[model samples]
Target: MNEKERAPIEDTHFGAVTVRQDGQDRIAVDGEAIPRVTLERDPAAETDPHIAIGTRDPAHLTMRVDGVEVGLLPAKGRFSRHSYRVDVEYDGAAYRFVPDSIPSSRLTRDGRHLGDFSSDGDETVLAEWREDGEIRPADAAIGYTLASAFGTGAQPMWMMIVDGVSNAIP
Candidate 1:
């Protein structure tokens, strides 16, 4: 496994919502698969012609774009893959990797809106964390990965290396 590699997208879950990669995003709305489009997917599909959207998760759904990924409907319980293309410059040297999609905002422990992670896209690299914003520092720590590009062995993806320090929830 490369140092930059992340966990397979299927194993990870968003917020309290859970969904599987490669499978359609069908959530049990009264025990029925309610079909819906993810917001992140909607924008990417409109902006980039290469985006391919999956089913909506009753919790949250993830969108795949030109190998990039982003979480849609995170509040519904999902993680974004790479909604935005970000360039990260780390340690006086620039290392640009795919940005893993995470919940941008969520209710805090005290019930307040707040950022999910802290990132400069130039300093700290991305990593995965629980919905509560706790870092496990485990090797198998859940993260994200990109689907292999056509004819390219490179599996482009990003993982949470340093959890973002978000703004205080009010």
Candidate 2:
């Protein structure tokens, strides 16, 4: 959708953090309405949509914090279209995001617990972080955008088959 036509899809608070996702698939945090991450739909994307964090390239899916860009390179699970797990590495840290259920996923960094990304089966989605200080709000926001926007969890085999058949017919 165009920028003017974009509407808010989610606006909710989890503890002190506020997360909002707009109709354009841009997600913002806290009181500032500026999008920190955006899910950019690209027809050329190999499997899933591309992500833009800050002013970085959407194709590379880099994360920018305080004007410094951190490269988020996919480490595993990139080939299988049905795979639910995605592993990435950046700044010497290994991050893993795997589905806990259809509407939620768990994020970990270097084998340490980080937080969760969940939806209420509606427009509202949340990213709640652990209290261990290992994860920041920006990190949680990135994780949430990745899991929610990328369709990170596996779809049922029957549903996949149905989708494939339907797409082929059309």
Give the alpha carbon lDDT tens digit for every residue of 34-73 in model 1.
1211222222222212221232221333333222333323
lDDT of 2 by residue, 1-170 (tens): 33343234343333433334443334444324322544433333343223222212346454443344554544344323335565655456777777665456778888887877765322245666677755554555557556544434444566668878999995
Candidate 1 lDDT (Cα, 0 to 1): 0.23
TM for every model, in the order presented, reads 0.18, 0.51
**lDDT: which candidate is best?**
2
State residue 107's C-alpha deviation in candidate 1, in Å. 26
Model 2 C-alpha lDDT versus the unseen true structure: 0.50
Q: Which consecutive 10 residues in model 1 have the weakest lDDT in total?
A: 146-155
Tell me how far candidate 2 lies from the true structure as C-alpha RMSD in angstroms.
Answer: 6.7
